[model samples]
Target: MKNVVITGTSRGIGFELAKMFAKNDCRVLALSRNTKPLDDFNHKNITTISVDLSLAEDIKKAVSFVNSNWKKVDILVNNAGKLINKPFTELTSEDFLEVYKINVFAVAELTKNLIPFLQKESHVVTVSSMGGIQGSMKFPGLAAYSSAKGAVITLSELLAEEYKEQQIAFNVLALGAVQTEMLEEAFPGYKAPLSATEMADYIYNFALTGNKFYNGKVLQVSSSTP
Candidate 1:
């Protein structure tokens, strides 16, 4: 069995990923701000750690807890992110900072802390938005969100190169309009081509076996043409 660590397991794609991995008998460490939703699962293999990723201290504590209990991490999914839909003109520096804190900084901080525990041939996948991709379809109100996700892609690429000798694969999944609360919040009254469960299935399989085929790649997943 693999030891999988996933962030943002409170709801949306993260929640589904946790369920999928747990059902597959993976020892799952789920990080989220509120863990009450996960209580309904009641799976012994799934452990929920409640912490605000935006805070460095909280991330340090979470890393300490994981390191104390787990000897090796087979997979780490940096899926915790927030979507703030604000026009470029109205977006404040604080707004950008807030989004980047969760979308980029938190992922970097957590990944850096857990690198020592990652299995030599492990997989690290970060969830980024299609908007993060250069020349992808752009929306009016997602400037901050898109820019932050773009940073995630860059981080994944750089880490992949830096850790190439370690044989740890780093990849970014640039998702497009997954049917989650974040999508609904970003585009009200519009339906997404993919559902959260569908995304979770793809991510689970990718985390399990994708490293064998892909390294330092950004996979754009969508049913519609970008």
Candidate 2:
């Protein structure tokens, strides 16, 4: 069975993705700051780690788990994100850093630490945002969130190139409006065209097989203009 690592699994897409992988007979290590939700689910094939990606110690916990248990990771999904909605003028440096700490820095740190565990044909999929695309429609209060997402997209592209010889694929999914809590936080009352489970289904399939057809690419997984 494929060993999968997914971040931000407390709810929404991450949560659903964890269940999907486990149900499909894949071993999943689910990471989240609050592990209670996943702990309650208690699937035999799923393991939950309490990780606050902003902290180095917390990240080490995840790395330690992988080293101790699953020596190789077949798929790593950097699905954890942080979003702060405030006018650009009112946004402070701390605000930007907080968002980047979780959205950008954490992703890099986790992936870098896990590289040794990822073998040939391993897939690293990062969940980004449509707002990260340069020409995409921009929202009023997502300066920090959108910019951090864009940064990760570039990071994934660079990693894909750096690791191509090893046959590891890195790709970014710039998602559109998904009915996630994060989306609701960014755009209250806005109804998304897709549900978190629907999006998770797509991501689950891609993580298992997208590397064969694509790498170092950002796929825009959006049907609506947001």
Candidate 3:
């Protein structure tokens, strides 16, 4: 079984992806901000690390530790994300930078650091948002989140071209409003607009089987939109 590393596994798609990989007998290395994620089943083949994505030193240490232990990672899933709802006029420079630091910079840096240790035929899946691709006009208070995710897609496109020679596939999953803890954390009292499990399963398959026809793709998914 191949080994996989998934980031942002404290919750949401990262958590589910880690479980899916372990279920298939893959050695799943999961890194999140939380040292012990609440949903962690503590499976034998799954290893969990807690490191802050926004800190370069912490990320370096985490990468060094994983490389030392696992040797080669067959899959890298960038799935940790958050949302902040503030009007543009109310947003600060620090706030904008913080969003990009977690959503784009950290993801790119981790992917770059793991490039040498990634297997020859390994693939990378970037979990982005439809807001990144088409923009989120319906949501007025999400400019920072939307802009950061947009940068993610652009970064993926460039990496897809650059890494194709090494047989490292880069693909983006653009999702529309999955029901995650962050959704509730940021929007309390709001009913979810969609299913998180369905989105997670869709992403699981996308990472496992999508490389066949997806040389470079911005794959989008929504319960309402095809």
lDDT-based ranking: 2, 1, 3
Candidate 2 vs candidate 3: which has greater lDDT? 2
Candidate 1 overall lDDT versus native: 0.91
Alpha carbon lDDT of residue 89, candidate 3? 93
Worst 10-residue lDDT window for candidate 3 reads 217-226
Per-model C-alpha RMSD: 1.0, 0.6, 2.1
Candidate 2 to truth, TM: 0.99
Off by over 4 Å in 1: none
TM-score of every candidate: 0.97, 0.99, 0.92
For residues 19-120, could you state the per-residue lDDT of candidate 3 as single tens digits? Answer: 888888988878888847634588887887778888888788768876788778778899888678898899899899899999999989999999988765
Candidate 2: segments with Cα more than 4 A from true spot:
none
Candidate 2 lDDT, 8-37, residue by residue in tens: 999999999999999999999999988888
Clashing pairs in 3: none
Top lDDT hit? 2
Best by TM-score: 2
Residue 191 miss distance in model 3 (angstroms): 3.5
Q: Please report, in order, the local distance difference test score of every candidate based on alpha carbons.
A: 0.91, 0.96, 0.80
Say what the RMSD of model 1 is: 1.0
| Model 3 TM-score, 2 decimals | 0.92
